[model samples]
Structure formats: structure tokens, C-alpha cells
Target: MAAERPVPTHEVTNQVPPVVGRDISTSPALLEGLRREGGGWAEDEVRALALLGNSETWQQAGRLANDHPPVLHTHDRYGNRVDEVEYLPQYHDLMRKAVAHGLHGAPWVDPRPGAHVARAAKVVAWGVADAGHLCPISMTYAVVPALRATPELALQYEPLLTNGVYEPALRAPQDKGGLIAGMSMTEKQGGSDVRANTTVAVPAGDGSHRLTGHKWFTSAPMSDLFLTLAQTDAGLSCFLVPRVLPDGTRNAFFLQRLKDKLGNKSNASGEVEYDGATGWLVGEQGRGVATIIEMVNMTRLDCSLMAAGGMRLNVAHALHHATHRSAFGRRLVDQPAMTNVLADLAVDSEAASAVVMRLAGAVDRAMRGDEAERAFRRVALSVTKYQLCKRLAPHTVEALECLGGNGYVEDSGMPRLYREAPLISIWEGSGNVAALDTLRALGREPAAVEAFLAELELAGGADGRYDDALAVLHKELVDLGDPEDLQFRARRVVERMALLLQGSLLIRHGDHAVADAFVASRLAGDRGRDYGTLPSGIDTRAVLARAAVPE
Candidate 1:
């Protein structure tokens, strides 16, 4: 009646069955091509298509991000500022392009527990691993692109982005580049212990201040900028101190010495001396903890990614060696024990990656304007950052052991994990700091905690598998919201909270291969429970109180 609208020949053939099943496996020739292409292009295509599929949403977000300027500063590898040269328009353009291209989508659209943030973090970590740098540059990419958002101090810091002394810094030579480029952050006392900071930011009447103190470990000694934290009446406040003058010249800060240490050798750690080093206040007084956290959160997530990447590298090395090495008249891979070891390593790396990704996703979501989901995402991020780093290090070490004597050798790259793994657990916030923070966050925001639990329940966690995990965790947690034996129940209660978050994130973002691996990882907890004994009761309150009470 409608002019036989769909009676076309192709349409008529649609009902016919194929001679055999579709068999989508690649042919040998195509497989070779894919292998030759190194899979990156394919992954990019897949990643791109995923983003393109939601173009309308991301496009809108992009517009929003473009309206705001970035926090531009010239920094060395150690987070110190170099100078305030005019901002480079090219970088602004690139950042805008990254936003337009949907670099931000992974942060918000997927709505993972913490996976989004972790994704941005992973990018930064990869840069660190490859270039031995850690600026959390990827975070700006993720934050602006994904959330279409800007930091609160965007106005104050934006001018430095387009016009700052660091403009030439991005173009500086590698070896002779600025001092802070590949340095690490450290204090004579401790790494993330701001309260323990010995550096003093003494104000000079002209709205500038002199920074005096000794920094034990600093990354990117060649960097032009240092995001140094100091004690203020309000509390710990950070400043955007430059290594050079406003006229693009070197300042008084001196690199006192360099630390010859473990695997991050590609990264040069230095002891720095700042004498009357002038710096600009980054934000309001006493807001150092809050403002610098913008960078710290970014750094912590970066550490998680670095750990994951190291684990991935370790697993890859183990697999390659196992498949190639021979032992006792058989290929090492042929041995059941060796096979199990490799399998376990793969599983651990995969699971840890999944947890990190979920945390990253939550960060992405929060950036995208789901304020209600933000608090939960923050809690989830802290937990994942702590758990993944703690859990994956041992896994990596064990995997390296599968390589036997070879793993210990620096040339093998396995030793790097052992050396650098501590960076994750110690920096940003230590494992203990993270664990206690998770508990404290729950206590401070009970509704968010309940919401987080409800989220787990919604994500296929109502069944025995989820409940069993939670039940095991419950025995260790303390319900601060309710006074009933909360003190005795501290660890388990907090653990359950962690499990709930883990399970929820894994279930929600299980689409990716990484996420799928998490479903399998829950078995580890079960095994640990069966074979391992629950430790003696822990008083989280006391532990937290001790940490809170300063010496």
C-alpha cells in the first residue's frame, strides 16, 4: 500500500540464515595487521566511539569548560613554581580541544564509584611512568573536559595559564630543563604531614612572602614551579611559588642535594633549600589543605594509576617470561604451579585495575554535576586509592617472584614496583590515613554512608555473595552512627563499608574487561576469610584520635 516501502531486495534477504555461525574472530591476515598496529589505535577507536556515542552531552560540557581558564603555573618535577611568564595560548587551545574531543566523558557519563577519577589519574601516572613526571596535568584535562567545571580559584590562577613565566618552560630542554620537572615532594619530617612541615612562609609587606625551610625529597627538580605547603595561622596553606623571578629569571630557592634511591630513578629526588623564596597565595588563608587537595587528590589518584601500571607491567613481564622460559624439561608456563602463579598475578592486577577505574569513574561523575553523588564518590575514591595501592603491591611482588631471580634485577623492571609502591601508600594520604579517613568520612556524613550502602545494594549486592562479603566486613566495622558496640566493631564496620563500595563499583561498571575482573576478585576475600584469621578487635576511634592528636 505504501508503494511496497520495504520490499527491497536487501530487505527480503534479511530473513535468510547464513551457511554457518558468524564467527567474528579475526582472520590470520587481519590479526597480523591488528598486532602490527599495536592495538592502541583500536583501543582509541573503541574509546572514541564510546565518547562519540554521547556527543550531545559532552559537547554541552565542553562549552562550559571552555568558559573557564586553567590554573597555570611553572612548576618543576616536585610541584614548585618556576615563574609567572605570560600564559601560552597554545596550551589553552589544546586543553579546549581535549574538552571538545570528549576527554572528560569517562569522568562523568559512566558514573563509576571512583573509576572516572582513576581514569584521569591513570593518564597522569602513565606520563609519570614514561616521562618520569607528575603534574596531575591529566586531572585538568579530565576536570575541564568531563565536568565542564572549573576550580574555585580559577579566576585568580587563570592568568598564569595563558601568560606566565612557565610558557618557555614547556619548551625547555629535557636534561637542562627547569629543576622541578622530574622531582618528588618531600619534607625532612614526612611526605604528606603538613602539620609536620618545618618550612615557614614569612610574609613580606608587598603582598609577597619569603619561604624558608628544607625540603627532603622533591620531584622534578628541573621544574619551574613548586606547590609548597607551609604553616599559617589559619592552618596549612599552600602557595604558588616560582623558581624564577617575574621577569623570567631564577630565584633564591636552591636544590641542596639529590637523593639516590630506589626504582623511580628516572625521577630525580632532591633536597631543596628555600631562603626568602617569594610566592603568591593560592587561595584563602588556612585553605592550604582544601586548595592543595585539588592537587593532592589529583596526585593520590595518579599514584593509584602508577601502582596499577606497575602491576600491569609486572604481570606482562611475568607472562612473557613464563611462556618463554623452560624449567625441568617443560616450558615454565606448562608447570601447574607456575601457571597458577601467573594466573593469580593476572587476576590481582586486573582486579586492582578495576577498583581503580571504578573510583576514577565516580570522580568523572562528580565532575559532571551530580552533586548528590559527589560525597559518595569522594569516600569511594579514598577507599580505592588506599585499598588498590595496599592490595596491589603485594600482588605485584608475588608476581615478580614468579620470575624468580630475574625479577629482582633492575633490568627486568620488576624491582621498580617494589621501590615505587611505597610512594602510593605513603603520599597523598597513607593507608592508615585513608582507612581512618574513610571511617571519619562515614561518621561525618552518615547519610552519604547510607546512600553508599544503598548504592551497593542496588548493584546486584542484595544476594548472599554481596551479603557474605559485607557480613565478613561487618564483624570488623564500628557503627559510629549508632553507639552500639561501635568501638569494638570499628574495623569490620569500616571494612564492610569498603566492601560495599568495592562491590557496588565493580558491579556498576563491569562492562569493561577490567571491571569484569573485579567480579572474580571477590573470591579472593572469600578465600582470605576461609584461610586467614580475622585480627584482634581494633578501636578505630582510638586510632583516629591518636592520629588527630598532634605531638
Candidate 2:
């Protein structure tokens, strides 16, 4: 007999709820798969891999996107807003479909059967990419489903969180969603540099503020709700400016014009001119950057996975074409050269998929209230997003070429995938920022780094693959600051530490297809020589091997 499902309390207010982060206790069949087909990878690793493959959370997202058609908000060709009246019904249907799809899937309903929650998240990522809607609706929609560790400051966002913000905005003929949405925040003078943003947010009477600024690349031009980045007395902060007022009214959030883009034709990317528009603050004064980062961090992984899905789809199409389309008598799949290309494509896609799933598992674990797990998961997520998104465009290009002349044609569907792939890397802080984030994480958790190394040592068992890699990485880190060149030493230490932690996990895990994974991180010991850039620090190697368990 099947196990009974757990009852969950539905809270649709300021506090964003997290996806169920329960422990896995079922699925003997899947557990058997891990033991058999996982190719020597650890049990944790196997479980993590399965999370994205069969999660309920992602299934919901996919159903919603597939069900909803694109809704145009701004009538102007260049604007990027969704018409509130026309879009709400579709949005409601989409959210309901997502929720239903999720509930229907297992593991999400019962973690023991498999990693259904993780799989569902992946499905959602893919669906979002396929939908190609420029509306920031997803941005709002995503937060409420599973609030997790986010702050409860935005109680006003409760009504909006229900996927019902469009209702009142659609009540009237000229009603826009909120106030300022789909406005491009980037400028020609400063780019995405928030510190240099010239948008001025001056206080106005009636507890509102006027936003006067010029922004480029307004996505979803018809959005009445504009969330813009501006300079405040404290520094850079985001303001919630509406084209309409709080009492179901319209305000002065104006549009300058829209810009033509290479792709996303169904959507408009425009330059926006806000002529002293009324606005409300999002967080603390001058802390917009931090608030924005919170949103960006959550979504960056989504973007990366989206790009991965597009690449996967593109490659799948090409592989199918090669099998069916004939060039010289036999099919292209029959050609050894074409087959080799497909093999390489498959390998890349599978590897990318594995890493993305693992990262998602980490996020899932973190959301379930594990602090140590959360820190590493966040770091790993950022790195995976950076690496995967960067690889996506190249992978798609290769797949398109494999499809030959047909790939170049618009009707082939390869062009759309190719067009959307690059944005993953460009948006969400780019490659450099991502790399730096990885490096920064190492700086924060030196002990976690040590603990990870110790786990590798245990998994390695003396002179195994894990042992050899761990030793080399450890040696490099130990001797990194000997020359004492400050900046150079700091960089080397970070690089070595990152390599050490990453190599350790890979070695210990060995790419297992999983259901629930926890990378073992033993705390560092109190003894041993200090090896970081800072001299005279406590040595962490011993701590890692004999670190005490937390109470």
C-alpha cells in the first residue's frame, strides 16, 4: 500500500514558505537503483542526482508555462508589459496548473519515494524558458510558493503574492498592473552599475516618492508595476513605483521608447523615461543592491537551468533529425562523424544536467533549515549556474551546426534556442561576478573547506583517486603563502581552496545518480600549521580530521 500524504498549512502572506524539505524515507526501488547503477558514486550523490530528474516542484512549473500563452500588455510594439485584463486569467490558470502538477508528482508529496521536489524545480526552469514571457510575473509568482529563508518585510506583497495582483489592475480599461514594470534599469552611460545609477527618488507628499530617471532595456513595457534601482541617502536601493496608486489608481510612470533586440521578438526590450514617478521603498534606505542580490541569486540558477533545457532541447531535435533525415542514401545518424558529434553533445548535456541537479539538491537541503548545508549549497549553486550557463551557448551552437542548413532556418526551432542561450551568462552578474562569488565563499568557510577535504580523505581510503587529488590540492594550499606576496598569495590560496573543496566532493561522490545527498563536511581540527594567506592562524587540517559534532 502507498504511504499517506502529509497535510501542509497554506500561508499566503508576507512570509514566503519553502518547498517541503522533509527527509527521504521511502522508494526502495530508487534506493536499489542508487546501489546498482550509480557507478561507485556515494548514496548521497545518487539521491541528489535524482532530485531534478523526478521532482514534483518542477512538474508544476512546466504545466503552468505550457498551459499559458504569451499575453501582450503594452499595445506599442516596443513596450514589454502584459495587459492586466487579458493576462490575469492565463496567469491564474498557469499557477494552478503548476500547483496541481506538483501535488500529483511523488517524492514532493513523499520524499522517501524519490527526489520529486528537485525534479519539479527543473521542470519549471525548462517551462519558463519555453514560455518566453517577458512579464516579471514569474518573479513574483516564484517567491510565494516557498518562502524559505527570505525576510518577511514585504507584507504588502501578500495580495500580490497570490497571483492576484493583476485583478484590480485589470478592473479598468486603462489600468496597468501596478506602476512601474518592464522598465529597463540599465543605462548607456553606466550599464548595470547600480552605484552609478542617476535615477533620483525624491520624496513626495501622501507617503509616496517621485522617481525621475532614464533607463534602457525595459522588459515587459506594459507592466504598470515598475521595480527600479535608484540612489538613496544610504546608497543604492530599489523602489516599488507603480504606474497606479495603492488604492487601485494610475500614476505617472511613463515610458520613453523601446529598443529592438536580436531575439525575444515576442517581447519588447525598451528604454524607459520616468518623469518624477511616485514610488515606495522596497527595503532599508540604500540597501537596494542587497535586496536585488537576493532576487538575483535565487533566479540566476533558474536562468542557468533554463539555458541548459534549451540546449538539451536543441540537441535532442538535432539528434532526431540526424536519425530521420537522409543525406546520402542512409540517415545522418548512420554517419560515424555525425554520431560522434551527437555523442559529445549527449555527454556535455548529461554532465551539465548532473551538476545543475546536484546544486538544486543543495538548495533544497538548505531551504529545509540546515544552516551548514545552506551555505555550501548557495556557493555550489552560484558556481554551477556560472559554469552551466557559460557552456550552454557553445553547446547549442554545436548542436545547430550538427543539424546543418536546417538549423539556420527559422522554422527549424534551433534559432530560438540559440537566441535565448546567451542571456543566461549576460544577466545575473556575468561570469566574472560568479567566479568571484565562488572565491568569496571559500574565504567565509575555511573550516567547511577543511571538513570537505577530510571527508574526501575518508572516502579516498589512503591512496585512492580521492586521496591523490586531495593530497595534491592540500599541498598547494599549504605552501601557497610561503612566498608572501599578499595579493598573489590571497588569490592562490582561494584558488587552491576552491579546487580542494570541489575536487574532494567529486572524488568522494564520483557522479552518482541520487535521491537525497549530503556532502560530508567534517569540522577542521585545532592543531596543524596555519596554511592560509594570513600567517599565524590556527591550522585547519587537523580540525577537519577530528572536528567535533555540533550539538
Candidate 3:
């Protein structure tokens, strides 16, 4: 008998190629943003990181890191109070790369212009490798600014925080080669209302404080230090609590439990019990919010960038999927409906990049003492953070659906993307918190409003729709019937602000096709809430060319 022919049923056919070997740094929008936003000097390194980010090894590393969530070990073999959290090797690899690239606190130390911009671009490009690991990185990046409020603290620790080395072990801050920081602000009584924290801090007489309280959520438990909030005799205050005391003895930072989160599995968030934890004050007593607010703003910028980067990841995956898979006798990308979907996703992704990069530029300038840029950043960062973060969920959903059944599977990585999308919105602050914060800036901060309007006016006459939207936004800003009503309408107003901001940047500096489509679809209100609802006569081909990988 002739040998049986191999079965064709098991053969894979018409499947999309692996999303590897393609450099995400080659994105037209990102490249343009880098050059336009003063990050051109870092282009070569960005490209190199893109190669590593897209490589098969790092992709698998991301998967493995997520698959094996961190475990909390409250004790050692002899039941000693080690208070350690163990992570997979893959998690450490990602952290190592992130710290080595200066994504944590290097910009604060680097006097070069556009350091923040370059850092933002890196967050956008390499962050696709694994977002969960970057949470600690963001907190570390953020803590630097808050530390500046205390000159001695900033002077002593700034060098260690900005060191481009990653040491995962728990050691004395001085003994460690480098350091990672965390935030222990919230408590069980109050989530975002950090002032309600019950943590108590008393003077230790050696200039440090002894802190004792139950912190509801403390991420990166193994971090060398935490910018925690507690109540002193004065009032609410910020404290730097260390895991290991300088004398080689452990601090009383106990990990009660590791939170089983919805996403960001690679990282650990814990319920911490600080039983007389050693601490040092950051900024003045009774000025905790005033001090930490600076750090929150910086972290919010990263949250915005993370949302933008996540959207780009979604589009890249969706485009790659559609480019290769075929149904109905033609490639999915060739079908009018799917073409509209991919192009629409691309347009939004490009807009996200442009706005985020511009915000980074504002931050870099603001750091250099540009008062106008600082004011613009106040309102712009708040609104951009709100919109981009909340927008990522729907964008991820639409992009995932483009893959049919395959997308729902964990192996495809789309499910992880879907899970990660909602995190940034909920983080920093939830939707209401973010929206109300923007309203607060608009209502309470006159300089912020004036600067934001001035920034909008920069794109005047560039697009009729943008001009019209700006006019409407101006009316809405002033026509508040009541405080409660404004709070109720905050989300609506913030969404418009986000759209106009994106439109303004795209029109001024984005690709012509990308800019035109964004203005007509977003500002003109011809588009539906969902992707793929662009109005007729828009150049889908041209819009997609900027987003799609070259054949």
C-alpha cells in the first residue's frame, strides 16, 4: 500500500504572520513626533529599542512574565519576617531593560534638553514589550519630582534614583547599586482620597519618622523606598519609607497580601502593614498633597503615554492580522469595511501619538522654567490623560475583534491587550476623578485656561472644524450654569477638549492624510462612537499607508 498522504486538515493556512521583525519605531507619526518634539537626538537609540521590542525573544518574555504572576512570601523557611515578593526571571529582564534605558528617573538627572521627550518616545516604543513591568518604572520616574520638594532628600537620593542600574534584591539604599521606588499613598478607608489615610508618623528623633498604618495598596513591594502618605501631628504629610533600614536590619514593612489584579499580572501590588516603619519626610508637614501633586502630574503624563503606546500596539497587531489573513476571496485589509476599520484605528493611533509627544514637549519645556508651557501642561495633561486612557479600551476591543476567534485566545496576546487597556484609566485616578480634576484646573486656575486656549489658537485657521470646535469649547468653558452641573458635564467637556487638542497637533505637524482625516472625522462629528465610521471621500488608503507595515 502506498504511504498515506499527510493530512491537510492540521496544516495552518491563511494565518497572519507573527508580529515580529518589524520595527515599531518606524511609525511615521512617532518618528515625526520625535523630530518635532525635540527628541531627534535619541532617534538612533529608539530605533535600536524598536528592534528589541519587536523581537521574538522579548515578545515571548512579555508573555511568560504575564503568565506567571508574582507571589508574595511573607516569611522564610524558618518563619522569619523576610517580607519579600518573588518575581519570575522574565519580569526582572524587562525591568532591567527599562532601568538601563533610563525610563525610570534618568531624565531628572540628565540636563540635556528633550530628555523627557526622548523618555516618552521610549515609553511609547518599548512599552509594547510589556506594560505591567513599567508601573514601578513610572512611579520611580514620578517620585523624583516630588523628592525635589525636600532639597536634602533630593540631593541624597536623586543620584541613586536616577542611576541606570537595576538591583532587584532588598538591601540598604546606600549599599544597593541602584534603587527602585514605590508609592504607598492609599488606605482601605479612602482610595483616591489620600487625606483620609490613617497611617501615623512620629518623629524618631534622628530626623526620621516612625510610621505605623495599614496601607491598602502598595505596588512593587520590593522597591527600596516608597513615597507614602501618613498623618503627623501637623496634618497629612508625605514620607519616604524604606524596606531595609540603613543598618542592614529590615523595616517593619509587612506585605499582608498581594492583590489579584484584573491585569498587569507581571507586577505586584500588595496590602502593606507598616508597624513602626522607618521614614523620612518629603516636603513640609501638613503639605502632603501639595508635595505629592507634583509627582502625580508626572505619572499622569506617563499614563497618557502608556495609553497612547497601547493604542499603537493594538493598531499594529490589527493591521498585521488583516494584512495577512484572507476571507471572502480577498485579503481582510482589502475589504471596504475592514479597510475602514484599520484606517480608522490608524488615524486614532496617530492622533494619540501626536498629542502625547506634544505634551511631552510641554513637560520638557515646563521643566526648563517656561511659565507658559507649565500652565498649558496643567490643563492639557489632565484632559489628555482622561481621554486617551478611557479611549484605549474601546480601541483595543475593536482591534481584537478584527482577528475573529483567534484574537480571543490568550496565545494571540490580544486578550492581554484588552485587559491592560482599562488599567491606566482607573489608575492615577478614575474617570470621574480625572474629569473633575480638569474642571478644577479650568475653573480654579486662570493661567492654565489661558495657556490652554493660547495653545489651541496656534492651530487657528488650519482647519475649519478645529476652529469651530475651539469656539464651542470656549463657550462651554464659560457657560457653567452651576457647579454641580459642570461636574456632571465634566466628562463631556473634557472629551471635546481632548479631541480639539489632538486635532490641533495633527493639523499643525502630522501627515496631511492623517491630519485631514482626524479633523473631519473627530472634530467635524461625522464619525460614530466606534471605529470605522469615517465619513465618505476620506482617503483611507493614504491614512492607512502611514500606519501599515510595508509589504
The lDDT of each candidate is: 0.49, 0.48, 0.90
TM-score of 2: 0.64
Which regions of candidate 1 fall more than 4 Å away from where they truly are? 1-42, 45-131, 135-186, 328-330, 461-463, 472-478, 481-500, 507-551
Q: Write the per-residue lDDT of candidate 1 for residues 202-226, one digit (tens) a residue.
A: 7889887787888787654544455
Worst lDDT run of 10 residues, candidate 1, spans 18-27
User: Residue-wise lDDT of candidate 2 within 1-551, one digit each (tens)?
Assistant: 99889777785433212212211111222233233322223355434423432245533433343344334344446765432323334344433343333311222223342242343332433243233442344444333222222235244443333322243233222343221123246766777566788888877777666887888666665554556688767777777665556566455555555555555444445666677877776766777766566556656656655654555565455565665567667677667556545644543444444444544555455545656655655566666666667767887888788768878986555677677778777766676666666555556667555544454455455224435545666786455343335334443344334333444443344333210011222112211221111112322222111111111
Candidate 3 residues 1-551, lDDT tens each? 99998878777789887778787535788878888889899998887897788789998898999999999888899989888889999999999999999999888888989999999999888987898999999999999989999999988888999999999998889998889998888899999999888889999999999999999888888899899999999999999888998998999989999999999999999999999999999999999989989888998999999988888888888988988999999999999999999999999899999999999999999999999999999999999999999999999999999998999999888999999999999888998999999988887899999999888899999778889989999899878679998888999999999899898888888888888888888888889878999888889999888898744
**Model 2 lDDT, residue 44, Cα:** 52
- Provide the clash count, candidate 3: 0
RMSD of 2: 15.6
Q: Of the candidates shown, which would achieve the greatest TM-score relative to the real structure? A: 3
